[model samples]
Target chain A: MALTQEHIQQRLTEKFGDLVSNFETPYGMLSFEAPKDQNLKVLQFLYDEADLNFQFMTDLTAVNYPDKPGRELAVVYHLHNLRDNVRIRFTVYSDINSPDVFTASKLFSAANWMERETYDFFGVNFVGHENLKRILNVDEMDYFPLRKEYPLEERTRIDKDDQMFGRG
Target chain B: MTEHHQHHIKLPEGSIEKQTTTLNVGPTHPATHGVFQNIMELDGEQIVSTEQTVGYIHRAFEKLAERRPLYQITTLTDRLNYCSSPLNNMGWHLTCEKLLGVQTPKRVDYLRIIIMELSRISDHLICNSIMGVDTGAYTGFMYIMQYRELIYEIYEEICGSRLTTNIGRIGGFERNFTNTAFTKLEKFLKEYPAALRELENLFTRNRIFMERTIGTGPISAERALNYGFTGPNLRAAGVDYDVRVHSPYSSYEDFDFKVPVGKTGDSYDRFLVRNEEMWQSLSILNQAYKKVQEFKGAEAEVFHADVPEYYLPKKEDVYTKMESLIWHFKIVMGEVDMPKGEVYHSIEAGNGELGFYLVSDGGRTPFRLHFRRPSFIYYQAYPELVIGGMLSDAIVVMSSLNLIAGELDA
Candidate 1:
């Protein structure tokens, strides 16, 4: 049977004391918002101490909400522990100007590119990453494309005279 | 700890530094399988370091979904994993249906299972055939490609498009399974096993093929789990976690098939797992075809798919019925209402568990739609798989891993 949101919340409360702030969206997924400072520690506890061993980081991406101050960007992490067949969502919010968070690549090597992708798309700087660079787009591109404010159609077309190799 | 990246981070001063050459593998390369570019810093065929630059094929699908209605997203999903678009289409539609609390009829569920299983077979054929070609066994590749062509012919007979088949709508199939589809599929099922056996014999026994793949890129079950590997990649590591068996979506619980696993998680093991899975899929297909045939000539009840707002109308009745016409107009104009909710629906895709995470705000267009792509997850373990193996072995291992560039980049 799938883990009910209530069961998940009870389990979290039993394990983490008061660290977890739980909110249930109308959609049925339990959202657990933890402090950005205790992100890695809370994850370690969730994996090791509690049996919520979400060993697999299925996805790691970020969302940008510029209008919301103090919560301008959220680094969303989706985890699935195949052993118990349970899934969870862990999120850490950061400010827009200097969005830096600890890298989970230390815990799961699979987070290497996921963190880089989060960095590439949402511009959330992962502080302890060994190498963080653009993975999907050209490295020379100036801005994060997935951010809500990024202009998609502002790119100017190069003229024939400006082309170095001439028009095809 | 930092040996792989030291050369880029450190620099000796004004001394004449040697400038190494850079090789761009693809924005187009045969081995790449699609438009993906990898900028590699090469020291005479030994890669010092590599940077994979993807998204050349990113169609801004999220933006497109934002502009289009919920049901229209099915047409767009066909482009994501064209090799197995039916699975994606079903996943996307099921997510919406689940949000709407709609239950499809048993017949529709059976039809979905048949299409998705066939799609899985078609995808595995391509992955295994590509592995064969990468290992210099062209005969095996040709044989399986021929089988895949037959599968495509069946797909064409059913959906009108062989590759980009928008086979399913939001609630049920776009239309009922046609007679031509069943006949062609029955013929293919009869011949496909022999073709697969021939290809397996040709490649699995060849000494060169075995030598190239046997020990290349071996992964332990624990390591695979840590790396977030799923599907054949994980199954090859001795994990008995097939989504079809465990999650059992689309009435998959009704089928009887074995989840083939391997002791050693290597390229060779991956090959064995996929080959055996094709057999299991064939059995499942046979059963589905039988069940579908059993439902022939029944009085087609008014299509009970709950969300009439999203699913397409029947071509026969849309012209004559005023209510159908009005519903069609409402669907086209995005005036039909949907409840505000979110849903995550997944299925056993050819590669692994393909999930569609959808958020709807009672609007025609989805507020957010996220794809959990198997290739994207598997590719994260690429360096670990590729580093210890030789360059030639890297290519073979990559093929066996079935990392589709379209799904990865999207």
Candidate 2:
């Protein structure tokens, strides 16, 4: 039988039971959220299962929600099954204070740099990653640039006044 | 007491301690072709281990996208892969159209197809010729660069810019293709194939070139998939997956073409795969041009969608008409609100899958935008690829991968 979104969802719900929640089919793709600690278990199950083989890590990124107090960061994983050509998105949320998610670098080698990028931008600390330092930004950067806390433009520039640019 | 303790330090017998010298290839080497640094630990001419450092040209495009309006962000996409800027422009436009729920006409899609394939040809030409140049053959590089000049002329005729072409609008092109553009494209189509054949004869079977590239940097199919390789690189590893075939966005399903594959994912295989793809692109271009010419009288002039709120108005209409003036002002100022949703759309860029993962909250700009650049993902495996190979092989591998610094660091 060809793998469908419902089959994948059903398998996930059966394996993890109530651990996986927030099931959604946004734009005809299966998306769901898991606990931050259970990320590796979910990824391993998805990789090992014959009927639900999503081995290809298409993309890995994070979105910051400053308003959500307990869950301020969401790490999204896009996995693809080459045999079936089906894609599913898995997400895990963590608090901003102690944002530690298990690394998938051991399973998917592509996750090494992507996880480092996520850590560099959003400060999502992948616990077991071998080299979880900054990937893109300069080594001297003190703050995570992609988080919602910082403003887009530099506030320290003295040459241009805000009144001249119509901001004031 | 210290002198007595250091009196007899024993050395192991017959240990031929060899020194491995560390070399920094570039943030600006001629053969690097981009601003990227490769730190290699070398034992004589062979690389013992390698480390890569990118982001020298990083401008943080994703962060910039949050502050700019939708139309203004197209300029960012152009800089990502400047060699094939039209592809990035078209990919972003398609994503926005999906969000706006706009359906483009068949003629518009065909025109886009023609320009995209031309860009693909130009991109592959640069990659293949540069590979030749790296291997100490300058004739083929000079021979093929002239065709890229022709392709750039076609781009100029369409968008008034050659390299960083912010060519098309959200719904469609800014204007219809001129007769002069078509004439130039015709001339290109007639001449490029012979130049391509000549280029192939120079390197495909040449003994030295084959020895340099055939098994220089090899990646298996399973490993390539695990490392998130796509486009020509992945296809060269014997995986027949293509975004055009798998996802079928932007009327690619209507066209008929073959996805080429190679058994061994080596430098030579990558070169062959890209060469075969250029032929397929030419075939697609021919078909698209024929289909575009079939549109009749009034239909032929329709370049953009009918949605005035999203598409920009002409300068004359904006000056004279009332509604056009207001719409122009609103669009330029980005006062029009977008829908509340998230969408991920990808296109098969010259390098790989160039994806736009957008999250909007019905605001003037995106809440979050992530550009899934293929170069960023593929460059991750470079250190592992060149670890045990010769130093010369490292240069060849880098050229074959065709890492664009802008895309890599974006």
Candidate 3:
């Protein structure tokens, strides 16, 4: 029997029923969201389970959603099972006031820098990471640039003419 | 009195501790081949620990993409991995096409394959030759660079620029390939094999090169996976996973090729794997060219897709026709609305699986766009690979990994 999205979803729901929600297959990929605290549990189960061994951490990133009151930051994990050639996306939401998610660096060594990058840009703190500092940005930067609060352009720059830039 | 003092001061063997010296490789060094720093702590000549700092060339591309139109984002991808700019361009276009639900013609897919393979060859050529240069063998570097120049000429004939070739559009190519481009490609196919043979003869079995590279920076297959290794680096670690093979896109399934794998996952294995892949790319290029030639008349003339609102009109049409002029204005201004959905599309870039994860809220610009750079992923393991190794071996390991600073800090 081939590994399909339904099989993986069923296994996940059976283990942690109702804990994993918002299960949707967008463009044929299985994506779901879980609580921020249970991130390591879900990752461990996916890795240790015989049929669903998603050992390869394809990517780890964070998306900021300021409109959502409680869940302002969403840390997404893309995992791939090489044996079955299947992929699943898992996300965990964190509050803006205290954005802390458990570190997956112990499980996947690749998560070390990725978590730091997420912290650098989106300010999503990965608790228990050995070196949880900015990876790509200058350490002197006081604010997270990727957060929705900041504007894309430099606020201090006044030399540019708005009429020439089509803003007029 | 002096003899008594000396006898009294007799110390135990190994009492003195070895002092570790801290050395900075570069924010600008010749061996690093890019602007990045590696703070290495060394005990004598052996590396004890290493800390890396990137972001010297950080341009905030993702932030910029949030403001720019979809078509304008193609220019940003050019600077990501300049060695394989066309691959990035095609990957971005494929992502946009997926979001728009557009299907490109067969001829366009074949043309894309030819250009992409040529870019892949150029990328691997630079890496392998630079590996030779780092090993103190400059002849192979000089000999192989000429082929890279030829590939650039092919790019020039296809697109206007050579290095940063923004070669394609959303649905397909901006223009059809000219006859001169075909002639140049044919010449390249005929002459490159012999040049490659000579270049390989110089480095492949050379005892000095082998001794310098083999077992110098060996990463186990399991650890390589844990560190998110992909492309030639992961293949060198004995993993037979290629994005082109695993998830076929852009008509990759139509062609036949082999995914070269290596054992030991050392610098030597990486070099050999890249060399083998260049051969496979050449084979794929030949097959794609023949398949493209099979299309005749109207089929060959069709470069862009049938989607008028997305693809820009030709300059002549835009100048003469009112409807074309309006469509051109709308497309350039990003007034054309697309479906509201999120999509993650990846392509087999020269370095690895270069992916674009896009979130759309049915707006002119993307809600969020993220580039999954393989260089950024693989470079995190540098500290682990270099620890407990000789200082010189660190350089070999860095080169074999082919860490493009642009992609790393983007």
Top candidate when judged by DockQ against the true structure: 3
lDDT of 2 by residue, B1-410 (tens): 55554567678986768799999999999989999999999999999988899889989899989866689889999999888999999999999998889999888889999989999999888999999999999999998988999999999999999999999998899888999999999999999999999999999999999999999899999999999999999999999989989998879999999999998899999999999999999999999988888898999897888888899998899999999999888887677988987788889999989889888978788889999999999999997788889999999999999899999999
- Candidate 3 predicts chain B with a TM-score of 0.96
Clash counts per candidate, in order, are 0, 0, 0
Q: What lDDT tens digits, residue by residue, belong to model 3 across residues B190-279?
A: 999999999899999999999889997888899999999999999999999999999889999999999999999999999999999999
TM-score of each: 0.88, 0.95, 0.96
Per-residue lDDT of candidate 1, residues B41-70 (tens digit):
665555565666677877767556654666
Query: Which residue pairs collide, candidate 1?
Result: none
TM-score-based ranking: 3, 2, 1
Q: What are the lDDT scores of the predictions, listed in order? A: 0.77, 0.91, 0.91
**Tens-place lDDT digits, model 3, residues A1-168:** 679998999999999999999999887789999999999999999999989999999999998888999999999999999888998889999999899999999999999999999999999989999999998889999999988789876779878754554433
- Cα displacement (angstroms), candidate 2, residue B287, comes to 0.7
Q: Tell me the tens digit of each residue's lDDT in model 2 across A64-107.
A: 98989989999999999989999888999999999999999999
The residue-level lDDT of candidate 2 at B310 comes to 94
1 or 3, greater by TM-score: 3
